[model samples]
Target: MASTSSYSSSPCAACKFLRRKCMPDCIFAPYFPPEEPQKFANVHKIFGASNVSKLLNEVPPHQREDAVNSLAYEAEARIKDPVYGCVGAISVLQRQVMRLQKELDATNADLFRYTCNEMPTTQPAGAGIRRINEAAAGASSYPQSSVYYYNPSPWNNDLCGDGYQRGGDNNM
Candidate 1:
């Protein structure tokens, strides 16, 4: 086994991004040391890299949510010039939002299984419900919106119930 002495002493953005304590014996040892300069160059390049426009373009619309959420977190952490603590708070907020979204998705899929008359203990998707329940019961505030409709039923057109079933007076 290779000792970790060399990497811990290097100056790479991975070390910097980790606030320095995550050095040596860490999983990134193999990618560090020899490539420290290259890693620093990549991170510094991000400073000058094109805006998240590339992620916007590259990611499919459905999968873009996470990337957009992460980009927004990066922005709030960096710009908007607030006092020191808010940046950290924004990171926490982003994580909370992502967790809530995941919980919601799991809840919907569980509801789908239940409505379809599948056994509650059915294999595969059923396992996710346990995780969803645990996450909902945890300290974070889970979204209270109804997953009882619009999902599982192919005919349900209301994506968000924000009122645009087939274009109406309130359509925007």
Candidate 2:
């Protein structure tokens, strides 16, 4: 007796799941190789086989690989964290970013304070007296108009004009 049986190589994950022969030109062959059945299994379990098929069919060939990878990652995340999934991961990352930003702001403020404290307070000869005299003369001449006096300080600039003050009794 002679047997006329034929054997073919294993089908891709999709065809294996569907219990059909995998064609050479099947769309799922490239992404879902027969060796990695778990990848397709996860995707199929999360998103149904029919939905996966429809998605693969709708997307262009060039984009199908990325779509498959994205689907697989999302599926795995959903499996691990059923309640929040990727959103939970995103929330954690956002919190980390906010914390880092606050730390950075504090560091910058500290550096500014240190640098301001380290700066010299002494002015050139006659600079301070001349500025005081000029301010007095300007204040006397412009009694009705607001007069501004200049002072060299890192924290506060002596801006006294329009009823506003920097280091005076005015509201500003």
On residues 7-47, what C-alpha lDDT tens digit does candidate 1 reach at each position? 54663334554455544544333333434444433423443
Model 2 spans with C-alpha error above 4 angstroms: 1-8, 17-20, 122-172
Q: Per-residue alpha-carbon lDDT of model 2 for 94-144, expressed as tens digits?
A: 999888765655554444344334334563443331222223322323233
After superposing candidate 1, which stretches have Cα over 4 Å from the reference?
A: 1-84, 118-147, 152-172
Best by TM-score: 2
Task: Give the TM-score of each candidate.
Answer: 0.24, 0.60
* Backbone N/Cα/C clashes per model: 0, 0
* Model 1 weakest 10-residue run by lDDT: 127-136
In order, candidate lDDTs are 0.44, 0.63
Q: What lDDT score goes with residue 164 in model 2? A: 34
